[model samples]
Target: MTGDVDVRRIRNSSFLTWVGLVLGSWVGLLWGSLLFMPVGAGFGIAAASAMGGYIAVPLWGTFWGLTGLSGQRNKALRDLGIKVLPDDDPLTQRVGALAARLGLTTRPWVAIMPHNNAFAIGATRNSAMVVLGQPLINTLTDAELDAIIGHELGHIATNDMRRMGLARSFQNALVWYFGFSRTLQRWVRWILTWMSEFLILAMSRRREYWADAVGAALTSKEDMISALEKLHHKPRLSSYERHHARLMIHGVDSSVFSTHPNFLQRKRALEKEKYLRFVKKPVVAEEVLAAPVTLPLVAEMAYVNSK
Candidate 1:
């Protein structure tokens, strides 16, 4: 049931991948442009400058927001107490290897946080970072961790992380612009924001499913499922954890507005996948095999020899 677009076979080869930052930047810019968010807010932030707030704020926010997201990525992450691993770290090496196997030209930084959730953040693939919960990391197997990393990398690869960042920013801007009103204008703004959030949450849920599929394909169905199952819990949220709840990988939220799908739903979806499977003979294209070597030919040869 897996389509070619949905399930990409892991590739270990790429000629253009090794050429350093110039080529990598080109690739990232292309990917980033492809997934770029719009530059308009439902509740406009008037330009305090010459340009009206409606026009200028979005343009301004879109520009610096993306730039700041990339430039301050490390600082922002560290502020959350995420311990970004060094390049020489074993865990980093393992994740880097997985990124290579997935044919990712720009691998993200691997970080650990003292929370019960895993999530990815960045404006571009070049600046992407995947943060894992330390508790999960200390307890899970290497393969399982790879599965988790693969899913987060999927977000980085598709640039969904940026889309999420912008969507949330827009949501907050709306709150600021409309927060003071007490009349119909305020109520209307609230309705629009609520509707937008509902739709965004739906998209987020779908992205989670796709990321799970990508992880399963990049690692193994078993590892992804195991990782999800192991990390699934009712976490006593710290202020930081609760603040970034929407970005987290796993949660028990079953509401229509929940950013993530139910854990059991994710598990069931994974149960149907044949991704990143480990087998003596990995499924290869039929054309790659020697078509002339038929079973009947072997049987005929054996019969003649016996005679």
Candidate 2:
């Protein structure tokens, strides 16, 4: 049974891995050629320039990956009022226990944002942080919360975070490579970037399915379904929340640009898992987890925004 589950997890991850690699390589080749061609022409060494262009792909990609872009993003989020919980805190402790149960040797840092969402962020598993929001805590029962946590952990366990980071870095490099040119090269870069995004979003949606499976394994399928239903409804946001939401990049239309699958689609996918068929329903109490220490600050910000 364990082996079969592992196989399924591996299959899902492998599919995304190949997609990212193919798209990244295609973008890198085009980006590298554009960047080096001019420099090569000026130096009267077309061959050297061509080699340099090819080499730049892997070189720039490795540099971006090692530079800790995700860590920097995490820092930016912290500056915007996200607070990291200490390991001894109740919520952090609970998440740590859950991580252990999921066979993780290192526990991810737990943080709270003032928004109404939960997400995982990090370049690697050891540095990963699982961020939750006040509204999510206020809205979900303990079992449902467990399911969400499990889903996030699944992202870490499957290395989806790192893979996505690498893919995005490739996309970023392409943007940088094309930033100054007014020629047809810029248009080409735009088209390539669009294509890359589609692949990246597809991988993201697949990862969500894998995470939902993990959530089902950790908690009951019913709990996962209930959590998805709750998440479907947008929680009332303070003006501060609204402002932040505006700054965040969201897909206005089309799943091709969205990082997550639709809620109903995710729920239905979880229902189809073979293991879930035999799993008994959970007897969850109608109690939500206590709000973290950051809740008051979030609430205060919301209150001030409303006023």
TM-score of candidate 1 versus the correct structure, residues matched by position: 0.69
| Tens digit of per-residue lDDT, candidate 1, span 231-255 | 7754465777657766777753588
Off by over 4 Å in 2: 1-8, 11-50, 73-77, 178-182, 236-254, 274-307
CA lDDT, every prediction? 0.63, 0.65
Q: Write one digit per residue (lDDT tens) for candidate 2, span 127-242.
A: 78887877778889999988888778777777776777667676766555555456535575677678878877786776777777777777778898888777666754456544
* Model 2 error, position 73 (Å): 6.6
* Per-candidate TM-score against the hidden true structure: 0.69, 0.71
Winner by lDDT: 2
